[model samples]
Target: MSSVDKQLDELKTDVEQQIPNDITVTDVKYEGPELVLYTPDPKRFAGDGELVRKLASKFRKRITIRPDPTALTDTTTAEEKILSVIPEEARVTDLDFHHDTGEVVIEAGKPGMVIGRHGATLREITKEVGWTPEVVRTPPIESSTVSNVRNFLKQERDDRRDILERVGRQIHREQLGREEWVRISTLGCCREVGRASFVLSTADTRILIDCGDKPGAEGEVPYLQVPEALGSGANSIDAVVLTHAHLDHSALIPLLFKYGYDGPIYCTEPTRDLMGLLTLDYLDVAAKEGRAPPYESEMVREAIKHTIPIEYGDVTDIAPDIKLTFHNAGHILGSAVSHFHIGDGMYNVAFSGDIHYKDTRLFNGAVNDFPRVETLVMESTYGGRNDYQTDQADSEANLVEIINETYEKGGKIVIPAFAVGRSQEIMLVLEEAMRSGKIPSMPVHLDGMIWEATAIHTTYPEYLRDDLRDRIFHEDKNPFLADEFNHIDAGEEERQDVADGDQCIILSTSGMVTGGPIMSWLRHIGPDPDSRLVFVGYQAQGTLGRRIQTGWDEIPVPNPNDAGRTSTLSLNMDVSTVDGFSGHADREGLMNFVGTMNPRPEKVLCVHGDERSVQDLSSALYHEYNMRTFAPKNLETFRFK
Candidate 1:
């Protein structure tokens, strides 16, 4: 028998012997990193939760108890039982049943009510319906992306199960060789801040981290020419771990699936949904610009089919010899700092993907604590010596001052922001400012994918900081659902009306002014001396946003009337850049992260910045901590063991 089969047999025998006789064990199977036990009487253990906990502790694995397929109630009966069990005040939005796993998903506006006190309601529902209940929060604003993703998974339950089983077998496969040495290949985001990709390899396993794309660059995708990434075809890479949903960190993932990569992509549940939304929007923006996207939507669907959503802090085996864990990165809704425990604790490495060490209104600061870390790879996006930002309080005050100043001038405010992180941050700031009368109450237009992205954020409130989560969950106060924010969904005509009609605040995407609805707004407002153009996020070098900040008088924009024509617009708007709104850690924050890390690392590698910023941070680390430090460039390899 194969080693994996033998392992499964041993696990099954142990579980059968340990579980109570009342709970008949029908079968044991691997579902990705989890070992699921099928029983006819799952309710028996539901009341005694400690039984499953003890079993998990004894086996040193994640254990899931599910009702056997034969034991599940019919869909109609199960739905009826679920509704009767849940309170009417819960306002349940939708119920979906997955037959392969015997899981019924219940989406409701008030998830806490559905869960009940200490999960009593869930336990009762499981006992009565013979189906495990998974509660989801229905966002106040409807998100088509969330609906489509959930529906697609429901439709492809059987296919997803097959993919999970395949991945589980690979993860549990026998180890054949010694992990004598560990090496990392820097494929992208080393001396520059886009297309962040890295390959971590040992003698027995290979893993890819953050396969992204660089916008407005000649070479858009990561440096796949390295032998560690695509040398033996896409399938050679065992798994892909995403840090967040930013385009620079996730855009090119679908391309991997296009080239026959069927391996599981590990990420937070929010990251999975947000990345899907952004990638689809990427295709739309490319089509509007008359450019052919690297991959088609079919590849994106394939990617979704193969993704395995993991919660933060759950250590799961992605390969036979490597275990991965994720920590909150405090950059965006689902950003994470990935920790790799390779070769049964032979070595430990942590990759900080776009960390913001200071707490923002949207999220708590990045986590600095880890069990063990010998080598640390971190981003240095704002790591220059003079890259310190204003405090959050001061930044907010300045933003309010700017808004009021522009309002008094009888001019509109145009802010180019990233749809995922910066746009949401600005929304909170504006919502509070307007509510408190710090700034005049006016329409805050959400253009491009900002509305859809904001809707996704609302769906995952637990990922937000404690204060924000409590307000949304307990107080029922969602700042994103405020009255002043208007979702501009009526296409170009509505966007044009917002730009030309009134004095309001506009938050549009392609944060750097590279493309998207921001371009249209800029084209209309650029020559208006009364209007104010405010930048609240990092404008990458060579982007039009940066060019405008550097005093570019005239800019060329695509003519709306003609397909292959351009028009030059003179820049006369008042330009201002507010500091401290960036998601990346500035120099001081980056330094503090290393200094405050638990059991400080022995070596440090600085990445994800411009040439000077990476080098400056590496030098500072070497001098300040007296540690071995390096600023690696693309395609460079470093051995840790």
Candidate 2:
């Protein structure tokens, strides 16, 4: 027998020995780092909740209980029973049945109502209908991306199951050799701040972390041409661990699938959804700009099919020698600090992916505590000596002051923001400022993908800061659903009308003014002396936003009167940049993170910044903490063990 099959047999025998005989076990199989046991009498098995916990503890793996196909009730009857069990207040929107997993997904407006006070309703549904119940929340604002992803997953359930099975087998396969040495190769985001990727490997396993690409730069993909990055080729990569959904950290993942990479992607559930939205938007933006996208949309769909959504704090076995765990990065929704435990505690490495060590209006501070970490890789985005930002309160006050001044001037306020993190943060700030009368209430237009991105954020409230999550859970207090906020339609006429007609605030995407609706708004507002252009996020070098920040007097834009013609619009608008709204840790926060880390790391690798910033941060860390530190460039490899 194959080693994997033999190991499965042993696991099955062990489980059968522990399970009560009344609960007949039909099969035990691996399902992507989880061991799912199919039982003919799942209801009976469910009665003893402690049984599954005990099995998980004994096996040191995730355990799930599912009813055998023969044991599942008919779909029609099951739906009726589920509706009967759940309260009408739940406002169930969709009922999806997955026969392969014997799971009925119940999407409801109030998931708490569907789950009852203590999961009594859910247990009753499972007990009465012979189908495991999974509850999902319907966002207050409808998100077509969320809806489409859910529907697509349901439709492709069989294929997804097959992929999970294959992944499970690979994860459980016996190691061919002992892990003697560990090495890390920096592929990108070392000397520069985009295309963040790293290759971590041992003698027996290989893993890729954060396959990203630089935005607005053609041919700026990670150094996959390096043999160490390719290892034998794309197919040899065992898995991909995504940290967040930012285009800078997740855009080029589809290229891997296009290049014959068929492997499981481990990420938080919201990261999966948000990355899909951002990547599709990236393609749309590229096509509109007459740039050829690196990969086809089909490859993105393939990547989605292979993704395995893992919750924070869940320890998952990704390879024979490496176990992965994610912690809250606090940079954006579903951002994670990836911690890898390799070779049964032989070494531990932590990679901080765009960490925000201080709490923002959106999320809590990034997690600094880990059980063990010997080598630490961290971002140095704001780690330059002079990269200090104002306090949060001061920053918010500055923004309010800017808006009120612009309001008094009867001019529009244009704030260019990244749709995912900064846009949502600005919304909350504006919502509160207007509500408190600090800034006059006016129409707040959400253009480009900001509306859709906000919808995705609402769908995953638990990922937000504690107070924001609580406010969202209580419907009336939800800031995102405020009446003052308006989602601008895709029609150019509507956008132009908003730009020309309103003396209001506009939050638009392509934060760096590289593309998207921001460009259109700038063209209309640039020449208006009363209008103000405010930047609340980092403007990467070479972007138009940076040029404007550096006092560019005029810009060449596509002419409306003549096809394929260009015109220069004189820039007369007041320009301002608000600090302290960034999603990255400043120098002080970076230093604090290292000092406060539990059991401080033996060595540090600084990355995700310009050459000067990386070097300064590395020197500061080495001197302050007196730890071994290096600022590695792309294609640099270091052996840890």
Give lDDT tens digits, candidate 1, residues 392-499: 899999989988888888899999999999999999999999888899899999988899998888888888888888777653487888999999989888977776
Off by over 4 Å in 2: 116-120, 559-566
lDDT of each: 0.88, 0.89
Highest lDDT model number: 2
Pairs that collide, model 1: none
Candidate 2 contains a number of clashing pairs equal to: 0
Tell me the TM-score of model 2.
0.98
Look at candidate 2 and give me any clashing residue pairs. none
Question: Once superposed on the true structure, which residue ranges of model 1 sit more than 4 Å away at CA?
Answer: 474-476
Q: Count the backbone clashes (under 3 Å) in each candidate.
A: 0, 0
